[model samples]
Target: MDAIERDDDDIEFVETAYANVAEFVEQLLLPTYRRNPAKHRWDPRWWEYQEVAMRLEALWRSFEYLRLEGPTGMAVFFRDYLDPTMRELTSENGPFWRLDKLGDERGVPDAWPSESPPRNMF
Candidate 1:
């Protein structure tokens, strides 16, 4: 049926979006963990990062947990797909949210600090 096909496509789209978001979070957060093993694993910041990423992705597909303040459907994209606090920092050019900015605890860049990959056998 046409309805069944449409529903299936919608489900597929949601699954793909979630997968991409999860991959993005893993890539972004793993470096943080490596740079500050003691602090990140123990501190609430790590959980915050995970929570924000997960929630954002969920909202992107479902628009379930967001408050919007813009043109029709515009806020959904920003609210669901973006990190609210990080966006505040990066979108406004704030020092706390730059790729080159260092983390206060680890001295690693906010995104990726090192120019060379870690030397490993793997």
Candidate 2:
């Protein structure tokens, strides 16, 4: 969550930042989304997008609170938030909540792509 732990490649931040970024995701973000799926709905990807967007205002506040700007801010956003959510969304056992929520008594999951929940998500 702080600055990259190791910046071996000053020329390419991503290269040097990779390990630190993975560590950040695995350590902080991953736990929130992975171990505790209800902490956030990351399955089905879009739900995670929706959840993140719903908190966009807060995220922006965080962006400002952290005194981040431009690319650095974006990287922080990914490192602290998006990356872990993505991992959960794409996990082998992903979409857990989504699957759990679906398949009423009939036992047939609703693959309906009608609209985002809490409708009018825009």
Candidate 3:
């Protein structure tokens, strides 16, 4: 049987990072949460929070670069792409969230599917 041994330290980093991200989301989304569910729209305000989450994730990914020096990488895409749009939105009394510069590259995707077959089904 092939088994995977998990490292508690890595898991701890992931857990802590996840908790931080959740807190960020909650703070940014509280306003929207107060509105009726069905009345939700693709308002600029919502996107501001989304961008903030992206930047936060990027900040977390930057930690990986610190421990592993194998490759050149940066997670500033979220800020790069969204900042201009957000700035424009906010300039005219539109909703927006000001996210710190995350850099030129965006953070990696939030989720990835397993490559292996299902357990006991293969």
What is the C-alpha lDDT profile of model 1 across 25-96, one tens digit per residue?
455433432433222222224324444455535543343222222364446545545445444323324332
Poorest stretch of ten by lDDT in candidate 1: 35-44
If the candidates were sorted by their TM-score against the true structure, best first, what order would they fall in? Answer: 2, 1, 3
What lDDT does each candidate get? 0.37, 0.43, 0.36
lDDT of 3 by residue, 1-122 (tens): 11112355442322232244445334532443243323222232333355545654554344333323334322242344334433443342223222222222223224447688788985
* Candidate 2: segments with Cα more than 4 A from true spot: 1-71, 96-122
Q: Write the per-residue lDDT of candidate 2 for residues 1-122, one digit (tens) a residue.
A: 23322346643222223233334344544465444433433332332344433443343334333433565877786688566555554453444344443322112234557755795766
* Top candidate (lDDT): 2
Per-model root-mean-square deviation over C-alphas: 14.5, 11.8, 14.3
Count clashes in each candidate, considering only residues at least 3 apart in sequence or on different chains: 0, 0, 4
Q: Please identify which of the two predictions, 1 or 3, would achieve the higher lDDT against the true structure.
A: 1
lDDT of candidate model 1 versus the reference: 0.37
In model 3, the Cα lDDT at residue 42 comes to: 25
Give Cα distance to truth, residue 91, candidate 3, Å: 11
